[model samples]
Target: MTKKTKSLVVVMAVTAMMLAACSGNGNNNGEQATAKPEATGNTNGNAGADKQEEPVTIKVLAQFGRADLTENEKAFFQKVNEALNIDFQLVIPPSSGYAEQLQLTLISGDVPDVVFFPSEQDEMFINAVRDGAVIPINSYLENSENLKNYSYEHSWEALKTMRDDNIYGVPRTSITRNDGFMVRKDWLDKLSIEIPADNEVTLDQFNEILRAFTFDDPDQDGKQDTYGVGSYVDANKVLLPVLVSELGHYGWQKSTDGSYPFMLPEYDAQSDVYKNILLYTQKLYAEGILDPDSPLNDSAAASERFKQGVTGVIRGFAGHVNAQEKVLKEIDPQAELTYLFVKGPEGKVQGTGYGTGIWGVWAVTAESEHPEKAIQAFDYMLSEEGWDYLYNGIEGVDYKLVNNEKVYNPDISRGIATSIMRRHNAPEFFLDPTKFTKEELDRVSPWVDKAVATVVTSMDKGYVPPAAREPQYMDYKLTWDELTTKIMLGDLPIDQLDKARADWYKNGGEQYLKEMNEYIQSLEN
Candidate 1:
């Protein structure tokens, strides 16, 4: 079979298996799959399970991508069941409706023992902490050497606290450069365009490249159906550094004084730099340089366009590169992609405020029967040994270490539904480098290095709106949306941008700035 055909076959098999697995649903019995060490007389002395303590059952409220466990997943549970003297009744909410389900559960006062606050559940977590719905684990954490060590590498200080000074949650970190731009390198080669130095293209060179992509038929099919770029307004904010530099701050500007940029005169929408971005986007829309449907399309739509080879340039997280390449390669084996940093006049700059350093957090609810056991279980899970077991499967079964690099079993690597491997942590965790192969390590090395460098760069250049200013940010965002829509539709002239800025300050902008700085001062003092 052809390579493409083989990939399809493998994907189909994985899909079918996944369907079968999900279809065979069960209650939270996986937690009870293991017999007690005393009953089974199985005392191998795993690092996680302290054989001395009698097993305790704990309920966990976790986010699940889907319901039901694959055979491999079942095995993973069975292993954990034996390793730890804890019975875990996993309450998994459907991935699609997790937020709504969790919200309703919270409203009903049915918070579980150990609640997982994934990235999507941030707001809910904050409210829970504020309302005293979750128990604070600060004292427990101080005693956990493993969790404490893991916390140091991530944004534990910020993540642990809410409005209060006490630590309320344990953070999970996924450390990697999540954003970058990529182009169809095959198209560049086919069109005889020289790849720019250091994979950085100047604005003029990039425009030329886009022009060729749009008009010169770089795909060589003699059809004028291709678009130069695939971008939505959200992606544009990142892919176009000029806009990011001027209007980049989420809401609050970089200020030790906590000054709000939106409320300031100099950073108003009518400013020269800000106007350039607006006009440039308008120009792109008018000249067919940008995706015609970009304003209306969402990220998934743009991704579909790229997959169908309708666009040559796209921006996304670095981890998405492999997924994009896989899809594009399936369409045309010759299709090749490469990362690029498009440089504006100011030089190459990545989008700031990409993340809050914490993916999600874990908190214990007062309702948990055994809060200590729940915390202990989670503490162990974040340890080096537990991380290895949870991230990889059984050492010799699901993966093998060759020269200190982990090689996953074929079934796991091919996306088969299995219990022996998982990447999700109930509360918090980070990627383990020792589990990566040489090729995987090399592919992600640049992104990893760039992630570290960008942290420092972003500290000086990035603008993160203080959490206290979320409401003000929302109001400003609503106004900007209206203004952007008007500007794009030509209903409002470009010169009227100044009026919009003035109107923003008149509408709670001043109050927002004053309150924001006050909150910042309170935190600092």
Candidate 2:
């Protein structure tokens, strides 16, 4: 069978077994476990509430971004063993197929004692809760003051429930900032163009700049080879900064009456908002201002193309500015880069980003023989001392405080230190505050303030898809991708969006709207 077919088969087989396997396990139901003694007797930290004679070994399903563990990871785990007095047997699976793998493993009664999900909102996490694969840890968390203080209240609130008003997991905090655009400041200066203020590019100016970048040989190379913009995986991510400035938030337009414009049939063709965005995209594609390989390019390829001076402006996060600058300097020492927070029609820069909430959560599993001990171990890791170790590694070895500033050790490889730091699967939430200090920020990218300001000013506009209509959302996503790709490629006329909308509704949009609207109502009630 084909790979896709095999994945579907695996999912189906596991799902069928889940209901039967989960129902018999009373421990998996969101219930508080019986009081148990601690594995470590160490109350100095949040290791355990009670006392124990021996160390506890817990199997953990870690949702790692990459498949393999490095030497740094091994060293980090050794430290974890020493600090927490807990042995962790981690099940590391390739992140791409983790959801399917997790389901299959759980259904087969081979689930680990604990599982670290990439996101609390992930469909697999919800299913795991509903299917009784994981137990809620509300009682256990109540025992730890450190875990409570370190956790973001918003993240805790957002991730606690799975339709039963019970806590299922411990959420990691994260910062959400919508992606921004970066351009070569030196190129703008060379062309005698005034740099637009942070997040303040008018459509007219934006187009003009692209034309200059495309035709003016901004790189000072004799050949007119550079494009205005390079490759991006999705149109929404790269173009939303420009579009949301003129129009409101893309995709669903929420009204004051709690209605969604995209869901209503009247706005399907009448609004023409989606069509207009496409037309603009097509214009750039035809004019050779957009990267020709955009439809096929990944973020890495896009960044590489940008570094090679193949494009002048690309959409990315604040960190991309630092990474791109580092590489671009190697190629052309004189190259200078600046980040832009594209302004809306009203001259206000709106940013859509995540707050202090991560996609991953640490959860104790129903099958765990030592559930309370598992919670204690996780809580300990979130303690101040534990967090310090997880975030920086051995103070003088991996990193050190220089003049009261936490600086990475010059001798240690950055890659190794980073790998070690992420060994515990506790994701860093805010990139600026968690990773970058003020002095480091000033040295790395001074324009980050503009982006940060934009993000802070427009925090209310950030959007995440509703989880109520997840299945329908997936179906609609597939249809939307096919429809948008065809329109952008000129294979289908822009006017065909009306037909596309009808197809979407038939596919899943109608049910998605119904379910999402119902969910919104439920939240209000």
User: Best candidate per TM-score, number?
Assistant: 1
Compose the digit string of candidate 2's lDDT tens values, residues 1-525: 544335434543554455436444322211111112234434445343223445566766665555344444445554556555666556544455456556676676546678777677677787888888889877777786666775555565556556556788876545444456788888998999895444467678878888999999898879989999875665443322124424434323344344452233223555655577677777788788888877777777887888888989987766656667868999989888877655654567665444434547777888777887676666666666766665556656566677987776544442322321122223232233344656556644534444544543122122243542467657666667777766765667887788777777676666666665554444445
Q: Can you tell me which runs of candidate 1 are displaced by over 4 Å? A: 1-49, 71-84, 96-111, 118-127, 145-162, 174-178, 196-198, 233-251, 255-273, 344-348, 401-406, 413-441, 448-452, 455-477, 488-492, 521-525
lDDT of 1 by residue, 146-202 (tens): 776654332554654554657776665544342456788889898898875466566
What's the distance in Å from true for residue 479, model 1? 3.8
The 10-residue segment with the lowest total lDDT in model 1: 414-423
Candidate 1: C-alpha RMSD after superposition? 9.3
Q: What would you estimate as the lDDT of candidate 2?
A: 0.60
Q: After aligning candidate 2 to the native by TM-score, how far in Å is the CA of 162 from where it should be?
A: 4.4
